[model samples]
Target: MIKNNNIDNIGGMEFATFRLKEGVTETRLVELSHQVEAEFLSQQEELILHFLVRGTDGVYADVAIASSQEKAEEYCQQWLRNKVALEYLELLDKESVNMTFWSKIN
Candidate 1:
């Protein structure tokens, strides 16, 4: 579904981004982060790199490097549904949430 043909190293890299809801506590985010790290990244064999980053203005980044584009997006959406639910994630635009990937490039 994610067309990565023109991107570099599409086979081994993926990226996701979002914005956190207002009034979301740091402690809550930490707890969710721990749960995600333990349950998904640690348990899922297909995911080699997975991280959630929060930037200024509540911007968030959900990055992953997996075996394929579908796997990468599937993993991200699964995590979001199980962890943050659908209501909290804010999309700036349809395109900004698009993921970018990279690999060893050998």
Candidate 2:
């Protein structure tokens, strides 16, 4: 059975945070985001993603996957295989280190 959406200590959540590059219009960005969420991310039940883009500040996402860091990395790679999806965001740091964090609902 599928587990609840809320994150807990038992299910260690890994985060994949990224940012949007300049010149992508808000309308295009949102459209691409919805498509990615529904078509790509939703297909993977092992993943839970939170795409955050408020105003014009920046584009960020907190991706919580139900498995190891390697799986999380694989998921990220798969999500980017879409050409349209690739235009929406970029890694905040090309040299950033990957880390795992716990997620939970208050």
Candidate 3:
């Protein structure tokens, strides 16, 4: 199993924006989204980040995920390595453990 001591076990959301390649269609985007989701599900609960396909630019995708930052980055990189051409990628921000709404409001 994958293990990272620095990984934040606290569940939260991660937002990422990507630029697509040229001439990529909406139908293809949906298919790609599902593929990415399937890849993510393989990680089990440790990678329980919900992915949302925000939009597509040509052949790129603006995707977002809600999960641990470490896992998210790892997954995203793996995705790029295997899937679409990653023009650029970044970790927008990470919510601290106590910052999670589930924990904050409790």
Candidate 4:
């Protein structure tokens, strides 16, 4: 599963956070990160993002990104060998979260 939240312009760059499944390996994650970074560089898009992979056993891996979602998903597909499914959750920005702290948090 993947959770995404859009953050308002930070230094004129967009930001998002993703929560992913834990089955992915460190090597694959790094490869994906590099691919995404390359895509952002090619497109001249400023991206600030991070991913947290939650394992069934509760362990997690964090991957930081500065790229586009298209590139990220492409890497995700490749990492899963085109066999696993991914889910995305909409996330509010930090200001939005603070504004509605009483609401069910993501």
Candidate 5:
């Protein structure tokens, strides 16, 4: 779930953290991430870069950079409802989910 939804005037970045669900492998997550990129993220006009990262503690992070804060917020809200996005989300431990958006500063 989203932890903060604060908006800023500049472009922003999305930092979403979660743990993989039981039986979910990193390979599978990576494969599905590609699908989400193709079908969902790539469609966003202001999206700059979207990538997945894993921590030593097993927590995973989904990082997305957008050209504008408004577009970032818009994409985040819309992605939650996208079928491909939902499929990717299913790999994560639901209770571990936390998303925060950070706006770029001068």
Candidate 6:
């Protein structure tokens, strides 16, 4: 877990960066993200914010901020098993995945 006072209004954060599989377009990614949000994330009451961001290096990050560190960890575990989340993960390159959880101190 990350501990830094510079961060504020955050209890915990999940940061996952990866590259999409070959031939997967951003349009399909966004469409699947909506499904993940509705079917998985929305069910987590502790989830504060969630979004997908892209970098110039052709990598994308799936970010989720939660109300607590435990909730953040829980979400990460659940994400791996959730049907919609699994479907979403299918678009990403498995070997390129890097996921971590951080705890804020502020």
Question: What's the CA error at residue 71 for candidate 5, in Å?
Answer: 1.4
- How large is the C-alpha RMSD of every model relative to the true structure? 7.2, 5.2, 9.5, 11.8, 6.2, 4.9
TM-score of 2: 0.55
Ranking by lDDT: 6, 5, 1, 2, 3, 4
After superposition, candidate 1 runs with Cα above 4 Å error: 1-10, 80-106
The runs of at least 3 residues in candidate 5 whose Cα sits more than 4 Å from the true structure, single-residue gaps closed, are 1-10
Cand. 1 TM to true fold:
0.58
Across residues 1-106, which tens digit of lDDT does each residue of candidate 3 receive? Answer: 2332333554434454444344545566566556555554455455544444454432232433325555555554565565432312222112211111221111
* Candidate with more favorable, higher TM-score: 4 or 5: 5
How does each model score on lDDT?
0.58, 0.53, 0.42, 0.35, 0.82, 0.85
* Top lDDT model: 6
lDDT tens string, model 2, 1-106? Answer: 1234555422345664445445555566567767767666666666644454343345355454554455566666775586655655442333432445653443
Q: Return whichever of 4 and 5 wins on lDDT.
A: 5
Winner of 2 and 4 under TM-score:
2
- State, as a TM-score between 0 and 1, how close model 4 is to the true structure: 0.29
State the displacement of the C-alpha of residue 96, model 2, in Å, after optimal TM-score superposition.
11
The C-alpha stretches of model 3 lying farther than 4 A from their native spots are 1-12, 53-67, 81-106
Q: Which portions of model 4 show Cα errors greater than 4 Å?
A: 1-10, 45-106
Count residue pairs with overlapping backbones in model 6: 0
